[model samples]
Target: MWRELALGLAGPLSPMRQAQPVGFRAGQAVTQREWRAEVAGWAAHFAAQPGADVALYFEDSLRAAAALFGAWHAGKTVWWPGDALPATAERLAAQGTHFAGDWPGGACARVAPQPEPEPEPEWQPLDAQAPALVVFTSGSTGEPVAITKRLHQLFDEVRALETCFGSRLEGARVVGTVSHQHIYGLLFRLLWPLAAGRPLVAERQAYLEDLTRLDARLALVASPAHLKRLDLPDLAGLPVRLAAVFSSGGPLPDDALAPCAEGLGQTPIEVYGSSETGGVAWRQRAPGADAQHPWRALPGVDWRIEDEQLALRSPQLGSLDWFLAADRVRAEGPGFVLLGRADRIVKIEEKRVSLAAIEQALLALGGVQELRLPLLPGRRQELGVVLVPTAEAWEAIETQGRAAWLAPRKRALEPLLEATVRPRRWRLVSELPVNAQGKTTQAALAALFDPMRPSARLLQREAQRACWAIEVEARHPGFDGHFPGHPVLPGVVQLDWAERFGREAFAHLQPAFAGLDQLKFQQVIPPGACVELELQCDEAGCVLRFVLRSARGPHASGKLRFAAAGEGA
Candidate 1:
């Protein structure tokens, strides 16, 4: 049964029986009645809260879904922030929104379980025009901006989804790697499933091995970031059969299309839109198709082009007036071809340049796995490329110096881009620096060239180990008061970084520091020098090994022992 978004929690979306599976968590089923009772519990608790706006963050989609509907049922507008970072917390607090659901810093009012909710009259359906949600953009271009969505708009979007793609996903369990905090994830991973009576998987698949372990009929809700990593040769195909696969948050790279076909058993339907626009269109690539295919408009969504920028008028836009989008497009037969983003065009040295074109050229070189070319300001504005290289390119860069591998790529791009718009600064990385939504922000991208602080960026990460490439800027505080004219990195700072990384990699263990063995500082690590810190798990139950090295040699290497069961050291 496909329930309308207007019906929401009050409507009978699923059988309200004790055994009806509402969601799946770690392979266990959560009952529909159990979830309903939790939603009622949240509503009761929210009735006592003074504020009408709640900022929510939860890694588990089902629990977050309960909190969302509960607040809405209580006449509150829920704000979905992609992260609970300090900056986001401050912003929410500034807006007088109460923190809720898995937010850190003890800022949230925890949701309580309702084993036996007091039987009362059924809840009334929410008003269709009332404000229901405020979602933040992914911050790919700049700081995140909030977009308010009304219940009527969301209800229409859900109905549209049910009308267009409902048949293929009948009774499919929704599985996802993306967090529900983002708009795309919130729709496909949580809301759509509940509206259509499909089960949702609670925990995200952090590693491909975890997804491979599942034996269920599933519909994957994924982003380009996660889908691009699934191209592996050791695995022939995923054992778990998928009913459907959906991709958004960016275009699925042409290279990743085959992996989805191989591992997922179906060509993924790519949904195109933004937080502000909801969903405007979707398209799936047919086998053997090589050219960029035009995207068909979503149900009840109408599109037009004026001055090369695409504009839309649909129920999803929340108005009849056309909402102009940032993307430039060309009309094709019964569809449109996306040219690039008109908003990303930047002016450099009295010359106009398309940052999207520059980015496309870098991506076309084939070495780049992911990248962001943002305009950096100075006396002369220049571009900086924060790039994550592919596995093949990474191996070559590690063996041959980065300059050797990057030289030919730069030579190839010299013809594709204007010299004035060429990236002046480069930060080669293993992973893109992004928020929980996998959108790289302007500040994070610019941090690579920041001279005031020491930054640790990921170079590579594996099951047993994690490696970070740290750049100690010339004016880093680690240099202060070390020597009159000469400055060296302190041993304490190096140890601190190693310990911090271990904490992240082994967070589940809650490992407590006990003692250290094999500690050695071989060479003086000077300021303004770059180094690599590698943290690895030792086979012994409680030992963690680390190495701090540079081009010169190993600066330090040691093994750290943590407290074991009932043992101090």
Candidate 2:
């Protein structure tokens, strides 16, 4: 192979040339080819520039990949700000040389328009150790760390794809649902397809319904977050033949795996890897499969356990030969079983507790659709659980006779209600806050119990003509027992007040108490602290709003909802 820098190199011909009909809008398809040509032109433009770094902000996956490759061909480095938040972008820009993307009002220089150029010859290879890309990982301590990947590391990763799965992806069109900015998306969707001589799908399938309209035997590159959204009523009959389903980002729960197998006629192959190590291991969701221990390391990747955590050394890491990960894994003969992340464990009452374990336990309970465990900040060890009940679970909890439908732990924990976090604080929510990749952010988890950030939308609001005002002192009698002297108002009581106000505002609305939506206890409101109550209602339902302020500081503010008795009642 020759080595040089030039964009738009024609891929090597592969024997498998099945004209796989990919599903994409005509405009998008045309734009993909156009974007490729434009990227080649941009590569030439960048070749004339001094620095070797470029920032990309394009939303379209194909366009982003084209820009990324074009920069690489010009011997430039790609800097991807995965979060894309203003603070994150500023930090990246400070260290980066040039930036590209559609972000509005940022300090980075705008990407210049591409100029037309004559068709370039095939791309020549550059030094394998040449810097190719920079990806930022969320630091264990909440800061971000920039990890660089070399050309050779990227090539090795793409080469390992064949060994990771039994099938050859030659000539296979790749359509990814995950963002190209992330490691999983970058490797599976762009590099692997390019190395295998496959044409990449320019558009991302945002919804499961979009799959039905697609024309190719899709490889459905997805994350556990996307897989959870799929509600397959009957899996035995579907038109599409999925070559394979790949899941990463987080663990694919056993419950999610079963439906994917029955519906798609193929078990989802879970991938275990991180931003640092690239691709590591693979496992299939088969009957009696061990989720914790089924992972087999990819060929050419060396693995070992150190202090209960898994570490990997691979040819793909360039100068960095070894990378230690936070995943807790135990040896299983030739392979390993992944226990949750090492950071996920918390200590309570001198006993070690796994929030992930508690979440899995709560998810196993009947009527629970989704659950999240968030730790409260205080002297006492408090675990807060936010839950969204299935309709059946909702009915069972609301009707006293139906309470038997719950498991013992769920029943015991349900009464701690919306406000207090004791053995557990259970707050019912319409839906959990999951990010684009389907992973829940710690910020989002903390927001759940935060009474300050209520999830309910105010549909309608009307001040009472004859306002019935009440000033109530906030107090949690159990707080003394919870910590003995450092008492704080329970989150459930704050939610309860909101519900009571809902009943008061919509007197004619017949507030059918559905369940607690969501609640958060930001700063504790102490006993004897006066809280002002406000109430409102509309055609959709009612809302109870509370603003609690004390001489110390702003205590908490929140809203609650009561579903209307009927559709238009």
Candidate 3:
């Protein structure tokens, strides 16, 4: 692998060397030689610190590569913590010793950058099975799981790349908009180009305008998140040869694929794999291609079905045979079709329903850009959907009764019926929150739907100020043991709920809270408490008076105040 990279760098016969790949920015281009020098210098510096796990967090590709190679040459495991939250970083730091990519405030030795040499050494062969890269998987609930792969596994992934895209990528300059930390970015942006003896563009282009200034025939490695932002009409006139456009992280919405293909003149090649099993399959989003097939394993890799889930054993990871995956797949002649994750499927009222399937169906609807379907805890008959609607569609849904819009099963139900297992709450949104990989978190989805705790209270504007009432409700069935035995709603959850209610009430204003005064919890409101909340607004923000009421009487009561951040237009 290293040898090919070196040849691509120095060999006169190498296509990459002859082409002199350039990193295009606002209006300027940086040559491959300059990029190599910067990275080599960082490698030399990183080599000074032996055995220290280094975190590479640069936003720029050239800098990121330099930090990565530097740590690699130092023989230290490099941790690409992608866009992990601060809490995640603290958790990782607690688990192992780490050197930050950015300079520390108080450090001992400062390694100086070295000059580029005239003759580069021949690339040395790397042990295929030796641990080389560590990427993280966003765990289902809490901490992210760190998965390690050997150099050979990466090589196998590159081999898969050749089979899937060899025809299109010959002598193509590789440019990427995805982060180099994740598997998708690691394989497409760094390893694939290095293995194929192709020069990679050192900058990460975020906007379509930035990509347009570059030379044509470029292989763009991007994610569905990045691609979704592109305006097809703007990209249509650019000189993009578009050897291939690769997307991963999540299923690329079909609506996005058609226009992007029409604009770029090439169908996007989507890769399906995870942190545990490197590269699994590749499929082009052509007109009639099966949207559900598992990627054909590379030449040497073997695949089989274990308990309805796909299992793979590759020569890349020696001694490790049959790594089980979460994806559910069925045989399709030479290949297999993916049927979503087995874990993502939930059983509601004896009916098996896949949240991913429901979300896909909702996305297929007109003006629905993105949607999330999460089963509310303890509610066997209830489901919640957070949807982002187009401006026109948003108006239509608001004007047309929300219940009227649903055909039958898609609508909410009052009394739990045998056949009424559809989503109960449908929250309209301008945009959905997505993680770095473009996947939404359960917590984020819950925030969109529930917004506030039952104990919290806020003021709402009615037609007149003649009436005031304390409304309290417990809708979350999971609220029972959000804590152990002394289950009281979390403070942050209460604050989130208040903010959500305020945002809805004062849609035109950005509401802020000065403070909560005389906040008292009178009683324990268990899960499933139907509560009512009333709010009164004055110059000193809005005051919330809430009561968690049951069928008999009030279960709990509380007051909250929300101050407007600043004067609004």
Candidate 4:
């Protein structure tokens, strides 16, 4: 019956007399009647431009849903970009496409939900097999892949999800930390709840502090990246209690899961799937459940281990053909245990190296909070590592020097991994680089190794002021690939150097960074240019002002804000 309703196979719609609440916007209820009316308004608005493909980008789920359904009603398809960043806009422009979002690019006229919907717009059923949505992969492993979904495939997957977990979530209000643009968010946060008659919260809960406002029963649709940062103290006395929490996008480490279950009311149900495959398998580790719990395949999803890779055939695919996944797994009893991805294995010096195995080994080391291991460019087969040290490890480095801090940890890994597989170069950073999707990309990972972009020299020091002379050369990383014929230091590199120097010279800004503000770039510094860096720490020690100047004029200036020791953004 759910599948029939989802696939528009349930018969003609009857007029609903009373307004059923669909969601909340700014603490105000949005009714089913209003939503349908909005959909109708959008349909009429787009009908004039029928058969046009639209790139949709809405941060609000309710408005996004109205636009999506309206587009389908008008016989049009919707495209989703990986993000709304400038780079994504450039990519879309390269493809000669226009977008309909809250962004600035005026390639297409923006369509928003009507402030007040029209009265009594007629309802209509959509063609079940028409192409509906285009979703892009996270691009964590490689370039993002675009996958198109027919209405049947998407609706069938929603039905399957409801059948598997809907009973436990009945009557639960929907809340999310993840963005509605991704597949998990599209299904769980919007479509599933809409079909289940559950109301959605308008605002996205980005910070742990945001969860404190929940006062009702909730079905949280979230990702591991967000869940790992849960703060127990901040979540206390919330107006809302969680009935179920759903996590996806990446593996939920045991370290994060235990705390989440203890802090929240229930253990999270982690969904294992990708953009191409909707909801494949799920697992929830009870307080006393086995440490090596396997993920059970969803209802109607048939799976098999083919050449160590997981393969599936389900109605969600709109056919009986098996779809192969990159994940390697082993069948255990009625389910399967995922053994990393086959693509993570790389060759170094003609020797096979398992990047996953090395990472897992490194994670087992004490004082390592988070880390990423990627192979270096060229045929040398060497590896590069970006590591985020735990507070304890960072303290050790501050007190004992970097070599003393790294010696024992490196020795511990020596017994577990081969020399060829060990990372040759490592970078320590305050946090990992993540995109809007909370997934780190290969490009972001490689950018951590940017070679000595700026050389710094301490010129003078005083009680509250410090001065440094910096030099940028042609071989600097900031200049490479910035432009074909011309090269200049990027503003981000300048800010990074300022922050690094500020931390070294001032004791107050140590530990964590809050944010940067009041940034202005007046001039571009070319190669082989020498510049002066001036920094001042206020009496309160929470703010630092930095300025970069050359013989001509100021290159850049910004104010760096710091949160004391444990407090940070």
- Please provide, for model 4 over 482-533, each residue's C-alpha lDDT reduced to its tens digit, 9 standing for 90 to 100: 7768888888888888876675566555467888889999998998888999
Tell me the TM-score of model 2: 0.59
Per-residue lDDT tens digits of candidate 2, residues 1-569?
Answer: 11111123545323232223222333234333354465666677677767768777666666576677778778888887654556556676687567666665755434445665655436665556777788876544434568888878877877787666637343345776777777888888767765555566767767655666666666778876667667676333442557778888776656666667667666677887877788888888684454664688888889899989998888876644567877888898899998767676543432234455456545655567777777765444477766777767656654653224444756543432212223544455545655546667766666655543332312234543112222232333424454457566676666665654354344444456554333445577655554444454544555444554445555556555455566222
Highest-lDDT candidate: 1
Roughly what TM-score does model 1 have, to 2 decimal places?
Answer: 0.62
Runs off by more than 4 Å, candidate 3: 5-19, 22-33, 100-112, 116-125, 139-141, 288-290, 293-295, 317-320, 344-569
Model 4 misplaced regions, further than 4 Å: 1-18, 93-98, 106-119, 138-143, 238-240, 287-291, 344-569
Report the Cα lDDT for residue 521, model 2: 54
**Per-residue accuracy of model 3 over 1-569 as CA lDDT, tens digit each:** 34544222333334455336435444355555655565567666766655567656655555666566655655667777655445445655675745554433423223337665764433344444556667665444323467776666776667767766778887677888777766677678877776675667767776755677776568888776556556776785553567778877666655666667667676677877666776777677774444664466656668899989998887655445688778888998888888877666454532334555455446555677667676665413357877666667756755784445554325222111224455766765556645445666776677655534332212235521111122233445435556775455554454445455544343332365555665555555554444444333343436654444445564444555555566332
Query: By TM-score, how accurate is candidate 3?
Result: 0.58
Candidate 4: residue 554 Cα off by (Å):
38
Candidate 1, residue 371: Cα displacement in angstroms equals 18
List the candidate numbers ranked by lDDT, top first: 1, 4, 2, 3
TM-score of each: 0.62, 0.59, 0.58, 0.60
Considering every candidate listed, which one attains the maximal TM-score? 1
Q: Over 4 Å off in model 2, which ranges?
A: 1-36, 48-50, 106-114, 166-171, 233-240, 287-290, 344-569
Error of 1 at 470 (Å): 20
The residue-level lDDT of candidate 1 at 351 comes to 31
Once fitted onto the true fold, the runs of candidate 1 whose alpha carbons sit more than 4 angstroms away are 11-18, 113-117, 138-143, 231-240, 287-291, 345-569
